[model samples]
Target: MKVSFDPDVAMLLRRVAPAGVVWVLLALPSQSVYADDYPCRVALCVPSPTNPWSIAACVPALERLFDDLAHGRGWPTCEGSGVSMNYVNTPFDPCQGGLNEAGPGAWVIEGKKQPNHPTWFYTDPASYGISPSASPQQSAGGDAVANASLACVGKLMGTYRTYVGQYNRDYQEVNVAVYDQIVWQKPQSPWAIDVYQNGQFSRRVHWK
Candidate 1:
């Protein structure tokens, strides 16, 4: 699937992926359309990577919680709790932010129609100050999962050592990083899709 994130989700992903601190009310009234006193959904979304680890580990657990809440999985009492979790993931596992982003990782989430969404990301490494072809990670893809944003992609850039290191040992490290922002027009062509890196547009894709 192909997708894009709202500015709010994109902003949050770029900020928190590097372990930046974000503040929110975290307490909302039991009902919507309430007063300004409504609680906020304060949270962070980052990449999960490892031998068996992932850039999306915490996502499914949170998704399950959403299901639980919607299902009323015997947790109606949990509503409006001081803490609430929100997360998103795609391509199933391995997380594009992880070391093997280009390998065989695809989150496969149902998303809006976009074309050639994955090639820019999985085809190259993220090389700074270089052209897209030179930088493998210059590519980008997004869906409902803003976790698929710049911060997580930063984890992709930091993957240099993984490829250079002997035996190519796994390298899963998320450090401070900055994003420029990726913005694009809704695709004019049915096959074309937008791509963003560092919260900004790196390029667009066309249908085969």
Candidate 2:
């Protein structure tokens, strides 16, 4: 049988293929998927190498994040209790700062998406001083099980990484990171966040 997958899913499968992972396709229902929705039906509409800020759902939060990064603002949070998102340049460090500071790594964004919508978005990453990678090594999970997403893309100028685990029934949060020219290392405790379905996030403790 012929089966298709989201760009993020397809990329994940390729990356995990070396581990001998068996691919299984499950039928999902069409609904308003986001961090704020209950029984969260998250559909990752943004694709890697593209600025998530362009997505209608991700505009608000991502725009805020970009602003914070540009101004050296503290960590940004989502709309929910005990939920926040952090952007760090170094791995495993609570000090969230600009990706240009890290000096080595790639910034990426991985997630699930509605099968009907194409992963590509007409967004400009250059505005954030971020460029696309022909082949990105960093990746994350987007299955319903995780009910979350991640981003680890870019180059020394700005490498990104994050893991958005399910925060609660009301919302979800993401951990975004950027690397420099060195290498990509997983964070010790990726920032925790709680996000609503509308793309709004909360700012909590920063890692600077």
Q: Quote model 2's TM-score.
A: 0.20
Question: Counting only residues 3 or more apart in sequence or on different chains, how many pairs clash (N, Cα, C under 3 Å) in candidate 2?
Answer: 47
Task: Give the per-residue Cα lDDT of candidate 2 at 101.
Answer: 27
TM-score for each of the candidates:
0.18, 0.20
- Which runs in model 2 stand beyond 4 Å of their true positions? 1-54, 90-208
Give candidates' CA RMSD values in order.
19.1, 22.4
Worst 10 residues of 1 by lDDT: 45-54
* Cα-based lDDT at residue 23, candidate 1: 31
The per-model lDDT (C-alpha) reads: 0.29, 0.33
lDDT of each residue in 166-206, candidate 1, tens digit only? 35564333221222222212212232223233444333323
